[model samples]
Target: MQLEARKIGFYYKKNRWIFRDLNFTIDAGEIVGLIGPSGCGKTTFGRVLSGYEKPQEGTILLNETPLPKRGYQPVQLVYQHPEKAVNPKWRMEKTLHEGGEIDRELLEVLGIKQEWLSRWPNELSGGELQRFCVARALRSNTRFLIADEMTTMLDAITQSQIWHAVLDIVKQRNIGVLAISHEAALLKRICTRTLTIH
Candidate 1:
């Protein structure tokens, strides 16, 4: 899927307005980074692009086809915090199972061990949890990925490794990515384009 947000604007009952007339497009084999201050709606914008939110105005299109108001397929979101993103009771295998038919090799390529798949979420480290989260996302036939502050919590080494993992997925899958990050240098290293929001 190729994603395009056209003049989008959004407002939630709990907060101020966001994305006042924004515009951008990202296709397969490209990564676009979004940067902004906290609460400037960078994550919210990612959610909207990933089909988690519907904007009040403007269009969200995939391959020039108007995306539905709800239920987007073949696109997935990887959140900033992995611990909160996953279910405490669910085993690693269970989470990836939800996405269905995932190759065990894919997990290995993401730096996940097969033995660890049987463990619960709480047993994993921050970086390991994030890898599980990514594995879950990749289990689906996702063509567009929205990585909202995905590497902000990990150490520099793990962050770099995971960034490369994501890049590898994009390359092999011929996917498009909307990577939300505040670190300009790091974002530049991975993304083909970067847009700073407010």
Candidate 2:
């Protein structure tokens, strides 16, 4: 399987492109890194790739076909801010299972305590909440993962834990990963190959 962005272009304001004519691709089980300075469209590209935003030009394709408009997304995106990604009203357990059945093994690998499931989002630290987000994104149907600084806010230990779990799953399931980050050291440590934008 492959996810390909062909000549993609996007912008918030009219005619002022954040990125233009960008092209990228990743194959199954490949961990690819995307590096760029802030405001250079690294996150925006991840958003477009994961179908969160429509590109002004070009196409995002999965195996040469367009991404599905509705239902479970094959390409999952886990961004930096776990707080923004979740629902404030729901408990962590509900949020965790919102996509599908809970995978207990996954929770264990991510170091999610069973007790935390009963607590609200605000009850957990950013690192703890991020573990849930990462687990949520790795559902069985997910073929590609777009991690936009997913562990950037966490401490080194937490970051290492999360990446280990993600990499294990990616390898076992043959899931492709696109890790978007500004940290060169982190990218060098985790990614098989790196791509720079701008």
Pairs clashing within candidate 1: none
Where does candidate 2 have its weakest 10-residue lDDT segment? 99-108
- lDDT scores of the candidates, listed in order: 0.84, 0.95
Give the per-residue Cα lDDT of candidate 2 at 125: 99
Mind giving the per-residue lDDT tens digits that candidate 1 earns over 8-47?
8888964567767888898887888888888899888888
Tens-place lDDT digits, model 2, residues 1-198: 999999999999999999898889999999999998888889889999999999999999999999999999999999999999999999999999996896799899889999999999999999999999999999889999999999999999999989999999899999999999999999999899999988
lDDT of 1 at 4: 90
Deviation in Å, model 1, residue 119 alpha carbon:
0.6
RMSD of 2: 0.8
TM-scores across all candidates?
Answer: 0.93, 0.98
Model 1 alpha-carbon drift over 4 Å, by segment: 68-72
